[model samples]
Target: MTNPKSEPEMAGMETDQTITPVIMSGGAGTRLWPASQGDHPKQLLSLIGERTLIQDTALRLRGRATGFAFTDPLIVCNESQLVPIRTQLADIGQTAWFMTEPCPRNTAPCALMAALEIAGREPDALMLLAPADHYIRDEAAFHQAIGRAVPAARSGHIVTFGITPTAPETGYGYIEAAEPLDAHASRVAAFHEKPDFETARRYLASGNMFWNAGIFLCRPDVLIAEMQALREDIFKACQTTFAASPKTKDTRALDAALFAACPAQSIDYAVMEKTTKAAIVEADIGWSDIGSWRALRDLAAATDGNAVRGNVLALESKDNLIYTDGPLVAALGVDNLAIVVHEGQILVAAMDRVQDVKTIVEALKNKS
Candidate 1:
């Protein structure tokens, strides 16, 4: 493991004009299912290239024109993932702060904890909330978009990055921008949850809706205020958790009972849906959450109508995604199918039906 000891410290970046990268790595990423297990989720796996998704997300903040605004990312993840998070950070020579969670209370509490932490440390700090597992092909455009959002974030509005919909994707929620705030920004008209195929198609045709990218930027105080006003219980939960400065001995393992006691809700539900301070920024940076095997297959480039990963071997497969680790995989006459073998577990499902693969995992768990 390479030590980032010599790297310049960014401890006080909030004062020196830097954006705090708050990464959320708590979820099990169940959509990817068997391939992304509870013990080792998708964020820890090298689902894309040589680097894990978490690694990619942490490094994406570097080399920006925001004047060292992106540094020492504060990673909010589950307790089980601390070692891997540290290993990946050390492996890539990136400095980070770990905000560990003992239990999963969904994203609202997770993000609220981060906000409270930052607010306590630096009330004026602008933090960017991002998911660890996402695919963004156009790095330049992504950086440009980040730069564009800083101004809005600084202006006291909760900014959300909305990816311009290329197709009718039923997997992601949609955000409707009411009017153009500028060339790069707009006012959020409303938030829409994931829709059916026909509704998604209509959204695509409207050209006013963008896929909710789960990326947000805002000042810590603003988020706290908005959250407190929107859902007082969530705000109070985060306050109680932070009031005692949740123990850092075990990588800041949050109080499990307290976290579970907090209501399970997403940030969108707890705050964004009710806040009038919401702003949307649309960009075509080639983004996807890579939530499912089918989504991963769509993101992966196809060669001869097949997308293969890890130790895979295909003979007559077409339009298939084969992802396995260590095990040698062989496919014959398979089309539009996903085959994933990981740690003695195999998942085989039609590409279109990959969304239902979680049922198999649930069944497997029942047997265990």
Candidate 2:
């Protein structure tokens, strides 16, 4: 806790003016149960490489070879996860300013809190909002996308990075690129909700649609203005909460009472859909939201076409996902199933129905 110039994308931000990577780390993997819970969410879990997803996020945006000198990242996370998150960052020797949510109120308020806080110092400084739980295998391409988006951000247009859809993914939302903003960016024609498989195939065939990666870049002023104009209640509430919060080494504690009053909404619903200055950058960054076990398994390097982790044995099993913590998970004659063993809880899901695991989680909650 050495006193720096400022904190939370602040502190060392005294001189340098660069796009700050604001990592949102709160979503509990409802679909990825047992392993991803309220206490230990998806971002904190090491589902990918040696580092946890959040750690990997920090490292990737660590001003490495991105061709941009990004400031130390700022993270918006949950209150229940603070200690473990701090320990993880400490273990990795990465320092970041953290803003803890009083409760889960979605990305609109989170964006507001970050925008207003960072804008106080540098109104023109670009802020790039990224989800912590996502996986991007192509680091270079990601940096390239950010570089392209920075110009639009600097021009006062709120920009979102749209992933080039490799397949017709019905699970993710689509962004239709209306007009070419430039060779690298485009004017967002329409934001399409998750569509049926036929519609998704049409989107893929059109070549004008990109998967919404939920990554946003804009100046704090632009976002502040948009929120004030469109979602004023959320803006006001977050402003009050941000102003009341006491900044600490690892956490900025928002006013719990006030934050709870803020409207729970995503940025898309709050501002993006309505904004006239919305722009998008087509990014091919090998991206995956990892929203389900099936997604994680799909991204994993498979053996005999089955994704198996930990003490796993598979015989005649193909295209299935098996994960175990302390038990020897054996699968025979099973295909496209997700079998996860954690502690005393066992989750067995059909790969196609993995997204509905949230339903199971809610049912279990209701039972207790």
The per-model lDDT (C-alpha) reads 0.81, 0.85
What is the lDDT for 68 in model 2?
Answer: 52
Q: How displaced is residue 163 in candidate 2, in Å?
A: 0.6
Model 2 clash pairs are 6-11, 7-11
TM-score, per-candidate, Cα-based: 0.92, 0.94
Cα displacement (Å) at residue 47, model 1? 1.3
lDDT of 2 at 131: 95
Q: Write the per-residue lDDT of candidate 1 for residues 131-203, one digit (tens) a residue.
A: 9888788877887787777666766678999998988889899999997666677889999999999999999
Candidate 1 is scored at a TM of 0.92
Query: Against the true structure, whose TM-score is highest?
Result: 2
